[model samples]
Target: MSKTALIFWGGWEGHTPARSANIVKEMLAGHGFDITLEQGTSVLTGSDISQFDLIVPMVTMSTIEKPELENLVAAVRGGTGLAGFHGTMGDSFRNETEYQFMVGGQWVSHPGNIIDYRIDIAKPDDPIVAGIGGFAYRSEQYYMHVDPSNEVLATTTFSGEHFETIAGVVMPVVWKRRYGKGRVFYSALGHTADEFDVPQMKTIFERGALWASR
Candidate 1:
């Protein structure tokens, strides 16, 4: 059977959630996955989730309705893969406690957007990170609050540009976690559509999603 992917996008307009979802849908389609795109959290209800092989949430700054949120959680924990990027996955939910737990991280700050930083592909032997030549890009250097048990796949070193001097830290750029029987993968890149289109970032996302789905 052909694999299926579901994507729900919308929340705060500042992050351009729709554009992000489109990029993901296009990528997944190219790889032979049937894609379903929804615009709001309300769509999380239908029974169609069980038919999907993966779930991608692009929501970034809104309190999800409990029923809808629970359905999404159930879909994921029931073995449907979950994949997303940056605030759309983590660092979202202004104060929603459960949402943070599900995503496994929170974006605390980004002192300066695109201030020059270097992400080291930590899991160079892993298919997702392997062969990805380390490259520097001008984008938000995300400072994330990561879950302790997650398998960190990549990290970024402080480049001494804007916040590096004071906030000397190696932050997680890519990671994977297990939620019940399902797999979850997140990439802390994609601050913009252009960033999502970058060759390295696209490779990381595509590979990560395929890995998470397994």
Candidate 2:
């Protein structure tokens, strides 16, 4: 049977959640996934969470109710997979510690806004990044507070041109981890759907989704 995936897209308009969701939906569908797209977090409060093999939250900086957040967390912990990119996952739910814990990271800042940077494949043996060498791209270099337990796959060094204090710090750009029995994947790329136009970014993001799905 084909794997099932649910994507919730909405919250901060600056992230262009709808456009990003469409891109994700198309890519996953091409990978033979059965995709369901929703507009808000209300779906998280419902009982249908168990039916999905994977969940993608394209929401940014949104508040989720306690019950809704609990249900979503339970679903993932019970073996449903979760995966997302950029602010949608890494920068979301500023006030929810549990949510941030499950995600394995939270975006603290993006120094220099959109700027040129290199992403190094830290774990070249990992399938999510295997065969792909470090590459340069122009986008937000996300400075995140990450869980040490995360199996980091890629990283980028801070140039300190924007924030002098964090200069030379190697930060995780892509990582995967387990929340209970479920797989979780996150990438700091994808500030816009257009970023995926880069072949390497597109490949890593798509593979990350597939790897995270149950």
Q: For each candidate, what TM-score against the reference?
A: 0.93, 0.98
- Model 2 TM-score, 2 decimals: 0.98
lDDT of 1 by residue, 11-122 (tens): 8777789888998999899888998999887788866585688998898877788888788788778898999998888755667766667777888878776577778878
In terms of lDDT, model 1 sits at 0.83
Instruction: Write down the worst ten-residue block by lDDT for model 1.
Output: 159-168
Q: Which segments of candidate 2 are over 4 A away from where they belong?
A: none
Q: Identify the runs in model 1 with alpha carbons over 4 angstroms from their true place.
A: 159-166
